[model samples]
Target: MIEIESVTKSYGDVRVLDDVSLTIPTGGITSLVGANGAGKSTLLSVAARLVPADGGRVRVDGMDVATAPGPVLARRLGVLRQENAMSVRLTVRELVAFGRFPHSGGRLTAEDHRLVDEAMAWFELGPLADRHLDQLSGGQRQRAYVAMVMCQGTDHVLLDEPLNNLDMRHAVQMMRMLRGMADELGRTVVLVVHDVNVASCYSDRIVAMREGRLVAEGPTAELMTPELLRKVFDVEVEVHELAGRRIGVPWS
Candidate 1:
């Protein structure tokens, strides 16, 4: 479980997260949705320990993120940031193997290699394993990054804008894959996303943020109403129930 208490971030005079407190339970998909600059990505970054919060505390499974040892935290938590700078000319397989560094310390064992192979296959990157990062399409590169994150095999996975470059089919596939990981492997998946429909369909819980503060949070069904949409995104969206799932229809 991830526990965030009174988390706040700021850049001089500009505050990005304002006394935000949230609890993400273990073993399910939780999607963070909001407009741009809503602090969704910043919140995820703080939870993942990639960035420090100016105030409050974040703990993963009982370990304080602010003081946990790097390897200890990396072994239990994996984060995929929205901006992946690919200045190095590494192959996809090499990139995935990097996920094992916390465990292997740069010396990969046979088991580590097997796990990397499994992650590549899981993300459908086996065919592109030898390709350079710059040589792949945006969606392919995104999948490569996701595969690396999953290869860490951590109890918690934090993803920011994972569906950014994916096509419709790939986006659906990614969500289903994440669902399977949560249901079958009991991994806690936290994602920052813009698509309300995708969040409604895949997340067990939805967290709504606006203007750097969390406005609402609950089970997806309760959070997917038209009223919340208006409050969070400032748009009226009709929610239709089909086959026990809430489908959000944005007003055009």
Candidate 2:
């Protein structure tokens, strides 16, 4: 479990996260959903230790993320930021291998190589393993980056805007893969997503934030109501039940 207690952050005079506290349970897909500037990405960054919070603390499992050793924390928590840009040129395979750094310290043993290969095959990137990152399409590159995070073999995976550059097909594919990771692999997946319908379809839990505050959070079924959607997004949403799932339509 990830415990965030009274977490706060600010940029100059603008406060992004205001005494935000959320607990993400062990295994399942938990999506942080809200409007732009709702501090969804900022909260994720604070939990992952990518951004230092101005106040409060975060703990993963039982270890304090603020004081844990770098390798120890990296081995337990894996993060994929929204903007992934490699400074140097690297092949798909090479980039995936970087996930093993915490375990192998740059010297990939047989086991590390095996896991890297498995991750590539899992994401259907085997054919493009030798291809450079720049050679692949946006969706393909996103898949490769996710594969790297999964290859890290961590218990918790936090992704910020995993569907950013993908088209409709790729976006669905990415959500399905993430759902599989939670259901099949039993890895805890937490992500920041803009599409509430997508979250309603794939996520087990939803954490809704607005204006740097957590508006609501609960199981997908419990939180998908039109009333709650209105409170979170400040827009009148018509929720319809489709194939045993509640989908929010803001246009209605």
Candidate 3:
């Protein structure tokens, strides 16, 4: 489990995360949703140690993120942040192979190659394996990055705005794949998603943030209420039961 206790972060005078505390258990898909500047991304960064917290602590499966060794932590947690910029051009296969660096130390063994191949296959990136990132569409590039994370094979995976460039079809496919990572592979998957309906439809739990605080969090059914939506988003939303799935629609 990822245990966050009284976590806080600030930029000069402005507090981004104010005494935030949350626990994400192992082996399920959890979605973080809220308006912009709600600290969803910041919190994930703090948890993954991509950003340092001002106070408090984050622990991953009894390992403290603050003091853990870089290589040791890298092997346990894999994070895919919003901004991925590369100065040099690299093929999709080459980019994905980088995920094995922590395990392989840049010398890919036969097992590392096998894992890379499996990740490419999982994201359906075999067709574009040789293409550079700039050559592929936004959706395709996003999938390639995700495949890289998948190849990392960490027990806990954190992705921020994974559906940003995906079409509806690809968005659904990404959500399905995230769910599969948890259910089929027994990995803990946490993501920051803007689409509440997508989170409701696919995530086991929904954690909502507001003004740098955790305002609401629970199972999908409990988090889909119009009252909670109004509180978190300052807009009304309606929940519908369709095909045994709880979906949220904008209130008319």
Pick by TM-score: which candidate is best? 2
lDDT, candidate 2, 1-252, per-residue tens: 999999999999999999998899999999999999999999999999999999999999888888999899999999999999878899999999999999999999999999999999988999999999999998999999999999999999999999989999999989988989999999999999989998999999999999999999999999999899899888999999999989898886
lDDT of each residue in 78-174, candidate 1, tens digit only: 9999999877899999999999999999999999999999999998999999999999999899999999999999999999999989999999988
Which digits, one per residue and each the tens of the lDDT, describe model 3 over residues 1-252? Answer: 999999999989989999999999898999999999999999999999999999999999889899999999989899999988779899999999999999989999999999999999989999999999999999999999999998999999999999989999999999888888899999999999998988888899999999899998888888888899888898878878999887778858
In the predicted model 1, the residue pairs found to clash are: none
Estimated TM-score for each candidate: 0.98, 0.98, 0.98
Q: Which residue pairs collide in model 3, if any?
A: none
Give me the candidate number with maximum lDDT: 2
lDDT of 2: 0.95
Report the poorest 10 consecutive residues by lDDT, candidate 1: 243-252
Error of 2 at 48 (Å): 0.5
Candidate 2, residue 158: Cα displacement in angstroms equals: 0.1
